[model samples]
Target: MPRGKQTDTKLTLVSQFFYPDTSANANVLSELAVGLEERGFDVSVVTGQPAYAPNDRRDDQPRREMYKGVAVRRIFSTRFDKNESTVKRMANDVVFFLSAFLHLLFKRDEMGVLLLPTAPPFLPILGWMLSRVRGYEYVPVVLDLYPDMAVELDYLSEDGVVYRVWDQLNKRAYQAASLTVTIGETMEETLTEKYGPCETAVVHNWEDGSVIQPKEKANNEFSRKHDLVDPTTILYSGNHGMHHDLESVVEAAATLEDSREEDLQFQFIGEGGRKVTLVRMTKDRDLDSVSFLPYQPVEQLPESLTSGDIALVSMQEGVEGLCVSSKFYTAIASGQAILAIANEETEIARIVEEVNCGIRVDPKRPGQIVSAIEHWLDNPDEMRAMGERARSVFEERYEKEEAIDRYATVLRRVTT
Candidate 1:
């Protein structure tokens, strides 16, 4: 794990989404790839074109390019609307897997220490298969646990054959990985409890504090344009997927509207499967206080994130440890007080308690959410103090450089 030994190590990161794709996994992987390159490793990325980005932003990028010194190889895959249907999204995943597999197989000689992320869920299994064929060492980064999430969301039955097969495949992948990286301690616990012990590291997801630091909403362009400067905004920014308890938040918004809370506003920014439904609910209730906006560009993150007085982070009731929201890091980085809608056992809840950053309410509890919001509204000084503490905790523990360095250490340990 010496610095000198890292120069000879070649790392290839395989993910379905990468630069130009606005997905959370893509942004994290891209940053890691670039960071590793700067640390004297020959790093390359194999990723697909933009699928999660907005239509206007999803341009047809080149097949190959160099991004911030990291070699990027974009593979051809079906660009279906992921938010439209689950079947179409699966098809996209399938094509990307096959394309990535073939590309890696043909260039097997160039493959080195593989850094595979659990984006499409099949990527780690593909890594396991490739490592078997090429004798390459792979490190699987567990962003989301697959069958567990599916079962928790009630999308798949635990007694079903497909669930069993997927679970077994995941076991093989984790068992074969040189080192498995998880984003949170709860996730590490879940992995160990489910698949027994293995080489694991808990590297929390991060955001660049230098770029996403607190900004004044009065002077921020994104805030001004979106008319967020006047309202006491409670923002829910990020994916509105099934795993998130966003519907309950929407219901809370309805209650707040009924109570004629004019000064308070609920702003939902980003896209996901439940977006359409949330929009419909807002319309049906005629909730003028609730607003929806598309995902903003990365450059505007500072303004976009700081527009909120309180940031809402949630996960479905049963999916406490399955996945940790990356938005939590950004929310803290933006110096916004958090309103976590998750179980007390979850990582977000733990962080909220430890940092004294915000409040934690149970999932599907709209009444609790409303009460928490009211408390924040009444105690503005406490809310601002919590936001300050949140930013302090982010800088002390979850900054970008610290996380990238930890990943570099993990890679060097695995490769060496």
Candidate 2:
């Protein structure tokens, strides 16, 4: 059946990253564009070249192509190593923003409803500016709240001039948007509280259960290749950014090592600014049970995700509503019980508690993390049941098709 009424409105998705970029933001937007296209909307994506993967630069990829029935336009931008330096990353974002603005400006007549994701944190401001000039509707999808996130990370002071200006700009853009979308209730609350009451919708981030469902470790090739078959593995399989509480996780592992938990293993996958520090910490602690690996290919996600018995999801103590981890949905979809290290106010903690699918620990308490792991270790059957429940909840509430449909509904309401 058709997902929604076929519409003539041209939907353009704007972001710094998109297809061929392995970042969670890129992957989600790519899927959304294709899903909208499949639902009978004319969809186009304007994104920069692949820069998320350090070794995978796609400067040679065609500037324009029809990818999975969605028109994709790759804009020219600096492909800096984002993990290496903050300045270089900002340079890349600035160039992408300028280039995207120019590209969209020239195509103003073709623009209908602009779907903006906060990749560079200020991308929604561009959408707002374009909407004002072209009299077109734009929906700002709040992936990560800016200025506030920067403030929490200590990248910007709350009282700084830059923070004040950015926060004011954010308020203006969100208030002017036809509809603002947030990925979780906590985020929606934060948005409305900060900007005052405005049109907003909470659509949780999701994963394709059909693609990332449970698989036996013995039968999984990636698991076997990585030697993840034997131990009760705890996996942290996403960006190790500054916003995440990875140090607590490492400390928990160290504590577990001290307890002589020989049957437990900690695996860290994917790379980010904090990965180097994490690797050094593991080595300095002589954590033989801990392992670090680069991100696996997309095709191997099913195997890689199911390789672990527990999935570690975390965030820094104070940045609860600023962003939600996409890895949480993927973990549930892969039928892995979550070991969430976050504040009680976070969406992850709320869901874990509501569904009884996993355990939540305070990010500030490494001992709580260790205790949670120990609980799972002691009650293996209960842990397996939790994993099963996680997958069930994912299928019912957070599947990829369901999220895309909600997005379609939002787009329809905004455009009409």
| TM-score of each model, paired residue for residue | 0.96, 0.97
Q: Give the best candidate by lDDT.
A: 2
1-416 in candidate 2: lDDT tens per residue? 46453456688998888888888888898999999888878888888888887745745568999999888888888898988887898899899999988888868768678899898899889977887777767899999999799889888899999999888988889999999999999999999999997999998889988889898888989788988888888999988899888988888899998895467789999999899898999999998888999987888777888889998898888888899988899999989899998899999999999999999999879899889988988999999999999999999999999999998888788765
How much does candidate 1 score in TM-score? Answer: 0.96
Could you give candidate 1's per-residue lDDT for residues 1-416 as a string of tens digits?
22332445888999988887888878888898888888778899888888885652457888899999888888888889877777887898999999988888867668788888987876788888888887768898999988888888776899999899989988998988899999999999999899887899999999999889887779888788888888888998888888888888889888877874558789999988889999999898898889999888788777888898898998889887889999899999999999999999999999999879999999989999999988887898999999999999999999998999999888788776
Query: lDDT at 179 for candidate 2?
Result: 93
Report, for every candidate in turn, its global Cα lDDT versus the true structure.
0.87, 0.87
Residue 308, candidate 2: Cα error in Å is: 0.4
Each candidate's clash count:
0, 0
Best by TM-score: 2
lDDT of 1 at 111: 72
